[model samples]
Target chain A: MPNQDEIFTWVHTAVEAGANVAFALSGLLAGIRKQLDVVGICVVMGLAAFGGGTLRDVLLDRRPFFWVDHPGWLWVLIGTAVAAIYLLRTTHYEFTERAIQWPDALGLGLFTASGTQLALAAGTPALPAVLMGVISATFGGILRDVVCNEIPTALRDRRPYAVCAFVGGWVYVFAVRFEVPPATGFLLAAGSATGLRAAAL
Target chain B: MPNQDEIFTWVHTAVEAGANVAFALSGLLAGIRKQLDVVGICVVMGLAAFGGGTLRDVLLDRRPFFWVDHPGWLWVLIGTAVAAIYLLRTTHYEFTERAIQWPDALGLGLFTASGTQLALAAGTPALPAVLMGVISATFGGILRDVVCNEIPTALRDRRPYAVCAFVGGWVYVFAVRFEVPPATGFLLAAGSATGLRAAAL
Candidate 1:
């Protein structure tokens, strides 16, 4: 079995990557529903994929945005969006709309955990760190919705969306405050947040 | 008479303060229309007042957000919101709706010039600086509308809004390129942008 440090690194990388994909997928579906052209579609997809993380990085004063550091994700997102457009052409609107919730929930969980973790690592105090997580988990979808000319469903829906992220952030914070292993905290936080959002959906 | 440098400083301060007040008032009006409570009113107002500038600062990795440095603005904003609530309660919706445009336009002009100038000072390339100006001038209202569960008037209105900012940003860039006085650049850029938006209204 791998050491705790390797496990923590692996979990960290996975959560970030998973959140990026989930957010991008959600954004792409939203853009498609809006009947945006390819360029517009790509822009929204990229925003959903990178917006929250970039905001987190900006607030934390981290340099070289993840997308900048890894241009490969852009190509992959575009390719996926194009392929999905054709694949989902016959897919029902109701189906696509329903499909969005899954990725959105997953992204919320993953981003909340990762954003909070990163802030804690940067020495931010607990409450502000939790807020950073909520912002990271929620703002991308908000930006996408705003650009698409809709009230962000995150705010509009009666569902507990940002609340889940907030609670999940505190979960991670407390886990760290105690002596829980970092990887375990991440798993528990992400799981609970995603589960809460999924239940709301 | 004050020298050119003194005039530049005065103009800079005036434009930034003007933009902040305009944005804040616009947000306050929006919140009142939405019938949000006072706390909601204040949150939305602050977002419109500071969202764009905060976004610019984050993107540029600037430390000490404008609000953090000037807590006095918070008190002023809250006090103004309270005053406006009572003062404008008897005002007609049509009149208030029309009123929002003026301050919003003024904010657009001032923020566009200031954002672009700050980016230029930070050594961002001309095109990126212009883009930054647009973001700074526009995102605050977008944020306000998003929270208010309405389509952002910036995107919905048929008037060429963001385009005006773009053109004005270029005007500033060109003025600087030609070595016009900095104050003159600000005045010309702000005037043209505000004029263009006012014409649109």
Candidate 2:
């Protein structure tokens, strides 16, 4: 198990990787849909990265949030967007189709688990915790879709994306209540969510 | 001069126009910046149209904001966006530049007034009222800029847009306190905000 600093670093890396993948996928969708230019692609990608977290922070009345304080997220997003365009030019749709599902699931899992943990730490009740889990996991995609002028995949007649988040949140809650180590509980919850999402996809 | 219903009709017309113009401009900007696609443009426009009110409603804890209830605004934004593409294509940069200042000021005025009124009606303090006024007038544009990967124009070292909103809100409060007719007072406040913004521009 990692120390606190190591854990934070790992989480940040995972989140950044997740964000980059999601943004790249969103940009792909935007490009295919003819809803964006290169700049628009980057914009959509950035929204896919930060939109959920921003909304969650604003709603929870949290100050500064991660993006506001650590402005490096902006550069990360910009770099990822540029990389995505270059990668997309050479890569085929089949490549993305095969490549995206795992990381997307991982993103869903990690974001949901973190969201649930944050809400519980902030003293929100269980229901709100689960809701935040889903929100944190899915809202960036939702915002991306909305900006792309498409229905949110979570809100549409899609597979069980939010359900995975909801279930994972409950798992974390139970794990904490049973006095499991925080790291173990978070990892278990995130793993469960990712597994569920991957299976659905 | 008009009855309440008539006033609402005018208000509705102006709101529809303002909302469309705001979205259309944002879309155009996104296109020029080469940052968005068709869906991306539409999203930018829709968010630009509805984001301000949604933010205000969410902050004030008002449920089922007007956009969520009235889907007509969505259609309005769509129409405006489509119309704007061609209109913008034909229009010269200088003409577009000249056209934007007044509408922006008008939107600021109307949105600030409505936001202030809603906050007061919701029983928030006076300070929050002014904040909401600025939020309602400018946050949509801010969100648009942020998503488009640009610094929010409102936060830039430019004209005192939010300043007009803050001062205009106070002007509204004084007018109401002085028992001025609501319509007259509203017009006066909105007019003052517009004038201030125009002068600053």
Best by TM-score: 1
Q: Give the CA lDDT, 0 to 100, for residue A141 in model 2.
A: 85
Q: Give the per-prediction TM-score of chain B.
A: 0.89, 0.85
Q: Compared with the true structure, what per-residue lDDT tens digits does model 2 show for residues A15-134? A: 657755664576466544643555455556656776777687777877555554555665666576567667767876344445666777888888888889888999999889878988
The best candidate in terms of lDDT: 1
Which digits, one per residue and each the tens of the lDDT, describe model 1 over residues B72-158?
A: 776688788888777777764444657667867888888889889989999999999998899889988888887887878889888
A33 Cα displacement, candidate 2 (Å): 2.4
lDDT of 2 at B197: 86
Lowest-sum lDDT 10-residue window in model 1 chain A: A91-100
What DockQ does model 2 achieve?
A: 0.04
| lDDT comparing candidate 1 with the true structure | 0.81
The per-residue C-alpha lDDT of model 2 at residue B10 equals: 90
Once superposed on the true structure, which residue ranges of model 1 sit more than 4 Å away at CA?
A90-94, A178-180, B1-46, B59-61, B66-201
- For candidate 2, what is the recovered fraction of reference interface contacts? 0.00
